[model samples]
Target: MRTQVAIIGAGPAGLLLGQLLHAAGIDNVILEQRSGDYVLSRIRAGVLESGTVRLLDAVGAGARLHAEGLPHDGFDLLFDGARHRIDLAGLSGKHVTVYGQTEVTRDLMELRAGQGALTVYEAEKVALHDFDGDAPYVTYLDRGEQKRLDCDFIAGCDGYHGVSRASVPSRALKTFERVYPFGWLGLLADVPPVSHELIYAGEERGFALCSMRSNSRSRYYLQCALNERVDDWSDERFWAELRRRLDPATAEALVTGPSLEKSLAPLRSFVAEPMRFGRLFLAGDAAHIVPPTGAKGLNLAASDVHYLSEALREHYAERSSAGIDAYSTRALARVWKAERFSWWLTGLMHHFPDHDGFGGRIQQAERAYLISSPAAMTALAENYVGLPF
Candidate 1:
C-alpha cells in the first residue's frame, strides 16, 4: 500500500497531523503499536493553550472541547503563605482551556476517520526504511503477517521512547537532557478542586500543584524524592501531605476522597536537534520533552504539528518546498523558547536538593519582586498563555 504521508503513532500529534493533512486532500495513514482502548485510557496533561484549541477547531474537533472544557483567565500562585494571582488573559490578552489530551485525541480520531485517513492500531515491530532517500516505506506485523506501507514522507509523532528518534544514526543526532532530582507524586480523585482555577504552590517543603480534569474531578501533585514509591503512599497519607504544603485558607477548603488514580512522574527536559532529517520529520515528544511545570508538553506537540502540517500542505498545494525546507529551523525556534520557559518555571516553583540558605533567600526575593511588579507578571503571563506560532 502507498500514501502521500505515513504517520507513526496514534497519539494526539499523529492524529492531529492526519486530520490537517486529510482536510487538505492529502492521503495519510497512521500506525500505532497499542490498542485503541489503551491509547484512550492513558491520562495526560489537561491544560490547552488557546492556540491548541484553535488548531482543533481548524479540523472541526473543538465542539466537545468548547462545550465541556473550562476556560480560565488566571491562576493562583501560592508562596510565603500568600496567594498571588497571575492574570493570564488580562496581561497577555489570551487564555487557556482545561481539556484532557485524551479527549483531544478522541476528537481528532473521529475527524480523521471522516476525512479518509486510516489509523491501524496494534501494529507490531514498526520500522521505517529508506527515509533519507526519495521514497520511504514502513514495515510492521499485523497479526502474524508482515505488512508494508510505502509513502512519500514519514512523520515520527511517537513519544520519546518511540522508534522514530532511535532510528536516526547517533552521528546525525544531537540530544540534550537534564533530569531533575525530584519527581511529582500525583493523585486523581472525583472530589471538586480546592480552587476554581489551578493553584501552583511553592513552600518551604516543596512544590505542589492543584489542577483539575473537570469541575468535579481533581488532579493534584506534590514534589517528592526521585526514588519514592507510589505504593508507599496511601490515600490518607497523600492528602495529609498535600494539605501541609498549601496555604491555610486553600487547604481548609480542600476536599479529600479515595483516589481514582495515583502515580509518580519524574521531571526532565530533553530535546533532539534538527527535527527534520530527509523524508522523516520528527514532531512532539519524539523531538523534544519539557517538564510539566509550565504545562507545555502537549502544547509544544500541537505547535510542532501546526508547523509540520503547514509545510506538508504548502508542498502539496503549490509544489513549493520553502516550508518543507525550513520546517526544522522554524519549529526549533519555538521549541527552544518553550524549553527555556519550562525550565525557568520548574526552578522557580520547586526546591532543589542542593538549595542553600542563600539560594532560598534569593528565591524569596525573586518571588517578592515578581508579585509586586507588573512587568514581571506580564512576562510570565505571555509565556503561560503561549507565544504565537
Candidate 2:
C-alpha cells in the first residue's frame, strides 16, 4: 500500500487529520489497533472549544454536533460556598460546546467511510520505518498476514503510550512532566445535569467538577488519592462525596443515578519538546498531556492537528516546506500556553497533600482575586473558551 500519509491511530486526532487531508484531495491511510466499535465506545472529555467546533464544521462533520451539543456562555467557579461566574462568551467573544469526544470520533469515522477513505482497523504490532530519510513506510500484521504501507510522511496520533513518540531516539527527545499527587475519580450517569454550565468547586476535602455529556448525561469527578480504585467508590458514595464539595444550592439540585461508567484518571501535565522527529510529527496526546482542570486535552489535540493539517496542505498545494518547517514551533507555542492554564487551574482547585493551611489560604485568595478583578476574570474566561487558533 502506498499513500501520501500513513497515520497511526484512529482516535479523534488521527481521524480528524484524515478527514482534513482527504477533503483537500490528499491520500492518507489510517491504522488502528482497536476495532471501530471499541474505539467509539471509549468515553472521553465532552467540552469543545470554538476552534474545535469550527474544525469539525470545516470537515463537514458538525451537523450532529451542532444540533445536539450544549452551548454555554460561561461557567461557575465555586469556593467557600459562593459561586463566581466567568462570562466566557462576553469576555472572550467565544463560547464552548458540550459535545463528547466519542461523538467527534464517530463523526469523523462515518465521514471517512462516506468519503471512501482508507482505514485499517485491528492492525497489530504496527511499526514505522525510515521516517527520518524519506520513503517512510509502516508495517503491521493483519489477519495472519504481514502488511506494509509506504507513505511520504507519518503522523503519530496514537496517544501518550503510543508507538510514534516512543520510536524516536531518546537522545533527541526532551520530556517535561509532573504527576499530580492525586487522581480524579470520575463517574458518568444518566441523570440530568444539575446546571446548564460546568462548575469547578474547591472545597476543604478536595476538588470536584460538575460537567455533562448532555442534558440527560451528567459527568462528575472528585479529587481522590492516586491509589484509589473504581471498586472503592460506590454510586451512592460517589454522589455523596461530590455533593459535599459543591455549593449547598447545587448539591440540593443534584440528581443521583447508577453510574454508567466509573474510572480513576491520574492528573499529569506533560510535554515533549519539538513535536517533530525527521519525517514524523506528533499531534495530540502523542506530544503533550494536560490535567482535565482546564478542559484543554481534546481541544489542544485539535489545535495541533489544525497546525499540522495546514502545513501539509501548504506543502502539497504550494510545493513549499515553510509551513512544514514552522509546524513544531507553532504547535509548541500553543501547547505551552495550554499547559500553563491547566497547571494553574489544577493548582488552584485541588487539595495538595503537602499543602499547609497557608497554602490553602493562598489558593483561596487567588480564586477570590480572580473573581473580583475584571482583568483576572477575562484571562480565565479567554483560556476557558480556548485561545485563538
Candidate 3:
C-alpha cells in the first residue's frame, strides 16, 4: 500500500487529522488496532473549546455537534459552603460546548466513510520503520497476515501506551510525568445535572465535579484514593459520596439514578518533549497528557491536530518546511501552559493525604482569593475557555 501519510490509531486525534488532511487534498490512510465500535465505546471528556469546534467545522463534521451540543458561558466554583460563578464568555470572550468525545469521534468516522477514506480496523501489531530517514513506512498484522504500507510521513496518534512513542529510542525521547496520589471515580447516569453548567467543588472530604453529557445525561466524578477499586463502589454509594461533598442546596437538587458506566481514572501530568522525529510526528495523547480537572485532555489533542495539520498543509501546498520545522516548538509552547493549569487546578481542588492544617488553610485561601478577585477569576476563565491555538 502507498499513501502520502500513514496514520496510526483511529481515535479522535487520528481521525480528525485524517479528515483535515484529506480536506486539504492530501492522501492518507488510518490504521487502528481496535474495532471501530471499541473506539466509540471508550467514554471521555465532553467539553469543547471554540477552536476545536472550528476544526471539526473545517472538515464538514460540525453539523451534528452544533445541533446537539450544549453551549456554556460559565461554570461555578464551589469551595467551603458557597458557589461562585465565573463568566467564561465575559472574561475570555469565548465559551465552550458540552459535546461528548465519543460523538465527536463518531462524526469524524462517519464523515470519513462518506468521503470513501480508507481506515483499516483491527490492524494488529503495527510498527513504524525508517521514520528517522526519508521513505517511512508502517507494517501490521491483518488477520494473521503481515502487511506493509509505504508513505511519505508517519503520524503517531496511537496514544501514550501505544507503539508510537515507544518506537522512539529512550535516549532520543525525554519524558516528564507526575502521577497524582488520587484518582477520579466517575459515574454516568440518565439523571439531569445538579446545575446547568459544570461545578467544580472542593470540600474537606475531597473534590467532586458535577458535569453532564447533555441536558438529560449527567456525568459526575469524586476524588478517590488511588488504591480504591471500582467494584467496591455501588451506584447508591457513589451518589451518596458525591452528595456529601456538595453544598446543601446542590445536594438537595441533585437527581439520583443507576449508573450507565463506572470507572476509576488516575490523574497524571505527562509530556514528551519535541513531538516530531524526522518523518514521524506525534499528536494528542502520544505527546502529552493532562489531568481532567481542567478539561484539557481532548482539547489539547485537538490543538495538536490543528498545529500538525497546518504544518502538513504548508509542507504540501507551499513546498516549504518552515511550518514542519517549527511544529514541535509551537505545539509544546501551548502544551506546557496547559500542563501548568491542569496541575494547578488539580492541586487546588483535591484533598491530599499529606496536607497538614497549614496546607489546608493555604488551599482555602487560594480558592477564596480566586473568587474574591476579578483578576484571578479572569485568569481562570481564560484558561478554561482555552489559550489561543
Model 2 TM-score on a 0 to 1 scale:
0.99
| Residues 41-83, model 3: lDDT tens digits | 9999999999999999999999999999999999998887899
* Overall lDDT per candidate, in order of appearance: 0.93, 0.93, 0.94
Q: Which whole-number lDDT from 0 to 100 does residue 381 have in model 1?
A: 96
Clashing pairs in 2: none
TM-score of each: 0.99, 0.99, 0.99
lDDT tens digits, residues 136-156, model 1? 999999986899999999999
Predicted structure 1, TM vs. truth: 0.99
Give one clash count per candidate, in the order shown.
Answer: 0, 0, 0
lDDT of 1: 0.93
What is the per-residue lDDT of model 2 for residues 168-212, given as tens digits with 9 covering 90 to 100?
999999999999999999999999999999999988889999999
Show pairs that collide, candidate 1: none
Identify the leading candidate in terms of lDDT. Answer: 3
lDDT of 3 at 140: 96
* Candidate 1 wrongly placed segments (more than 4 Å): none
Model 3 local distance difference test score: 0.94
